[model samples]
Target: MSSTLPVLHVGFHKCGSTTLQAALFGRHPQIDYLGEPREEPRSTEAIRLVRDSCYVEERKRIRFDPERSRALWQEALSDVAPGLVPVFSKESLTQPEFYAAPDDPNLPERLRAVVGPARIVIVTRHQIRLIESLYLFHAKGVHVEPAQQWLDARQEEMHQYRFHTVAQSFVAAFGRDNVAIFPFEDMKTDAKSFARRICDFIGVDSQHGADLIAGERRNQRVSQRYLAYSKIRKAFGLYIPIGRMMPEAMRRSFNEFVAGGREARIELPATFVAKMEDYFRDDNRKLARDWGIPVEKYGYPV
Candidate 1:
């Protein structure tokens, strides 16, 4: 309605959402990044409207209020200066469970209602590695659970990696011509190329994107040593005291000493890897063939 083309980066998290939010999208002069990244803008009302409306079931069963959500969106849109690309970014949008494999069952219709038709951007990672990284991610949380327990096969997180299913939703919700999909591997291989593609999609200058992404990775993986340390600390009820009881320098030194040297990475079992391969192969292949993605170049499940 406002003649401003909105870009929605519906992050299937563990992809490059953080970097894109904090660096690529957030820093671009021509882009108006709204609502949430790894940074403070996270708790804003723009996207919380969608999150609250879409995920909250109790209200839905009673009586969903679409106008309330629309008001929040309209308010956010009012502040956007003309000629700047508006980007609503939140990786958790795709994963309603906050941080898990199973994506939101419903396409984000409430958000779509705000901006009649908007361009969508989706980024996906290799299933096996994505799951592995997720395990490592959760392991560092205050309560570290066993890898298997953290994974919780019952969640069927692997299915979320079927990239096509996720991407196609955006394609359907926004037009086929409006949805852009990028493989996470590309960012790993050529950050510049990846930056250019996204910048191109959002109709912004690509040059600045390159400079913004230099060594910018929020939520860097914790060291493998943290897995056991987190659990032991949780067991001892040490999730408090605000890191006091010792001098600042001594605490910093002690923490550095305990952290493992290598980045923490969960090693998936062979059987699990095989299962992931079987599950994602056809989906990935179809996605590549249809979307013209050079997925094989990255040795993805396909």
Candidate 2:
């Protein structure tokens, strides 16, 4: 067996990251997938420090001890089998704050200091679909505001979809050869094929990794009616206390019961999607040209 290679799947979420992560967790003998750094106390503190130091307020900075963070990460991955590749997948690492400044080295440098040399995997979807999915995700998870209001509040963050900028930062820090970008649209079309590609990239046997291709999806989107009802419940402050009181499994079951098998359809204004498509046109073209992703295949105009 080849020596284990450390792989970090820093997600650009609203993509198929949950599906990929679920597929890889404990299913392959040659790969050890750690779901999230925050799941462990030591790694949580280390990640928090990395985030704090990397994503400070404008004109402000915070410092953290690198040696401590490194030690924490080393400890976190110590339990994995020696010959198996170590994969750490975390979706929150793609939050806009880390990439807000195009030139910032803090995020990548901190990551390098802790994880050392590792393959970086980033998965992205077209901006229009991604943003709409993100908006619904926020509404379901935390925000009570209407979609338009929530979107308005996140204008700056939406720019993270200019994927080349984010990918370039990692390329600069980790070298171009170590960075891999996959389209979420491609994954949705052929998840098994996509999983095989990732396995090949990480130097694991494709046959062994094939088992990581099928599983229950995590954080599936609820229907429009369900979301609207959630909004009303939040508006009336009826959801807050109930959400706090109920266990997560119970809350999820209750939500599923209320949704009554409604399909996962979200109805955003057509003009809104058109405008977003226009807004991301140049960036999508650049992604196609530079990264070889045929954005047009995913319905983005090239």
Candidate 3:
């Protein structure tokens, strides 16, 4: 096994994954944050993998080949440790459909097979707020069906699929001792402290200090038009061109005009908060047991 495997941030997305990734990649010298030519907003290899896998499936309208999927997994692993403690933060891994069961025996086995004895970090937030933010996130990208419907479908998928279960996959693979799970809310609330905690867990120092913890919610906007465009692309199943095809001028316009200014804070409803509290209670319990976290310390209703 390679001595330095990538630090996999298997996220429960909208949990400040982008903000943390941007801060880390923006400042850290030793880390190589992967993305496309035009400062790729995303940070995980798994997104491309999932999209590509889905693309192939849609084209043939068929199921994925296990051998092919494994090959792609190997290809993703190939990029690991090109630098010391390279970070891979893809929330898709937490998606339920990816694993047969949340506690599936195959997860850790597969991860070990690919990334070797790795340290895993799982970040989570209140479910209701997560879904609301996700709605805004999806909204900011492209226009689509009714927001409530989208949320419902996503919730179903999440419940059926489960993120907490996915964490077990890593624990099974790396052993409970090697995995460090933290609350997304806590990180946002106290970035410096969280960074120190994370550094301690991963055996790295925080070069940038607490100041690196800049914003509570970063890159939090998507305009109606952007959403509409996104919806069209999704419905038609077209690629939106990965990066750098547009001129700088056009990119700026898209950022300024279409994106409705960078990092706009999303507004969420109170009801969503109530729902999330109910949803994550069990998951939090399981996570607390697995990672030895004080659930009350994070102040989640759980």
Clash count list over all predictions: 1, 0, 6
lDDT of 3 by residue, 1-302 (tens): 12465576766667777776667644565555453222323223334444334321245323433455446555655554644555666665565555444565554564555455667877777665566566766654534556556756655455622446666667778887778777776776777787767666665666453456655446654666566556666778665632246788887776566556344344454565567567677877776766666667766556
Rank candidates by TM-score, best first.
Answer: 1, 2, 3
lDDT per residue as tens, model 1, 1-302? 23568888888778978888888887899888884643224325556655655543454422335576567667767777888888888776776342233334344555566566788898988777778788877666677676666656434545667778777666666778898888888888888888888998888888788777766777667776666577677889788633467799988876786574887766766776787798889888987889988778877878
Cα lDDT computed for each candidate against the true fold: 0.72, 0.74, 0.59
Q: What TM-score do all the candidates reach, one by one? A: 0.85, 0.84, 0.65
Q: Could you give candidate 2's per-residue lDDT for residues 85-181 as a string of tens digits?
A: 8777777677877665544666877888887888989898877778778777777764466667777777777767777777888888788888888
| Residue 62 in model 2: lDDT | 64
After TM-score superposition, what is the CA distance of residue 114 in candidate 2 from its true location, in Å? 2.4
- Which 10-residue window in model 3 sums to the lowest lDDT? 35-44
**Candidate 2 residue runs with Cα over 4 Å from true position:** 37-41, 58-61, 141-143, 235-237, 240-257, 260-262, 267-275
Rank order by lDDT, top first? Answer: 2, 1, 3
TM-score of 2: 0.84
Best lDDT among the predictions, by candidate number: 2
